[model samples]
Structure formats: C-alpha cells, structure tokens
Target: MPSQSAVGSIETKGFPGVLAAADAMVKAGRVTLVGYIRVGSARFNVNIRGSVSEVKTAMAAGIAAVEKTEGATLESWVIIPRPHENVDTILPIHYTPESEIYRQRVEGGGAPLQSLPGNS
Candidate 1:
C-alpha cells in the first residue's frame, strides 16, 4: 500500500443506490467519495484512497452493494482501476454494440451528431 491516496470512479445508477453503496463502505471502514446517485442516472463517479487492501476492499464492497440495489446498473467501464496509472486498467474498455446507447451517453466519445438523442 503506497502512502499516498488513490482515486477510482464507478459509473453506476440510482442516487439511492449510490448512497447505499457508499454506506456499505462506511460500515467497512473510513473512506470518501463524491457525486449523487439516483434512478435512471447517467453516471456515478466515486474517489476512494487508502491502504491498497482497504481501497480494494471498499471498492469491491461498494460495487457489490450498488449491484444489490434494484435498477442499479454498472457499465462495463464502470470499474476504473488505478486510473492514475494507465497500466492498471484491467477491464476491457470497449463498449459492445448492444451497449452503444449507454456508452455514448456516458462517454460522449462521438457519433453522428444528428443521431444523438435530443440532437434533432
């Protein structure tokens, strides 16, 4: 565990779901996060840093807790591992065709401007 703090983000759904997930971490140990979660939410980004084990534990617990909530969904890219270190990104970063809608909404990477929702 490095002596410095770490950062992580989880793009999830439901404000209550985010809150519930956060609460679980508090139960596990001391940590911190940001943003508000709610239903049909576009995203949920949280930053938590501590001992490596503690941070990993909190992250797993938080995501698990979020998943337990009804209507709470996690994008495949939701887990941003060691974002500070590009090499630490373990999850596949690509979005499948089935997930294009949600992926575009969250990433805003780019697509035909006219095809985007509300673009018309």
Candidate 2:
C-alpha cells in the first residue's frame, strides 16, 4: 500500500446495503475493498482504501447504492486522507491476505479478480 493512500468506510443498517455499497465503491474508483464488518443489530460497514480523490468518488457511489437497496439504510461514513500508520495496525481496515490478491493485481497492471464460473 502506498503511504499516501486514503481509507474510507460506509456504515449501513443492513447487509444488503453494505453489499451494494461495496460493489459500487470498487466499480466507481480504483479502490481496494478491505472487508466488511458486522457491527451488530443488523448493521454493517464496508471499508475501502485508495487515493484520496478516488476514495471520495467511491464514497459517493457507495452512498447512492445504499439508498437504492430495498431494505437498507445508510447510517454514516468517513474518509481519512492520510491516516496515521498506527490506525492501520489496530483497525480491521487493513488489507487481509485474501484481499491482497486484488491489490497485487491492480499494482501489477492486471485486472482485479472476478468471480469464476460455477461448476454444474
């Protein structure tokens, strides 16, 4: 990850909203989807990281997605332009091994991973 990348998050009232947000976010910008968090009581959060401008763009798309979801609501969101390193160390926002594949592909000039066809 670049030292200057930004981190952003969208909190939604339901899993459907968060899922919508995550999909729109990555498609809207060259951002990496870190992961989702279950914040209890049916609430969830979608976290992402990318350039400051890209993060801002992704946040907009994500918020729109949440609003469009049938039974979901956007609760809150945030974008940290240059969060301190310690924040990455302690927060679940940091990329995991599973997500690293996408990051690596993006950095290596390859497209991010996509779903494979299901077996019959």
Give the TM-scores of the predictions, in the order they appear: 0.51, 0.88
Q: Which window of 10 residues has the lowest lDDT sum in candidate 2?
A: 111-120
- Encode model 2's per-residue lDDT on 4-66: one tens digit a residue: 799999999989999999999989988889999899899999899888998999999999999
Instruction: Give me the candidate number with maximum TM-score.
Output: 2
Candidate 1 lDDT tens digits, 1-120: 233444444556556556666677645644444333332435654444444455567778878878898887755323333345443343232224544553343334646657766678
lDDT of candidates 1 onward, in order: 0.52, 0.87
- Give me the runs in candidate 1 sitting further than 4 Å from their true place: 34-41, 76-120
Clashing pairs in 2: none
Cα misplacement distance, residue 97 of candidate 2 (Å): 0.8
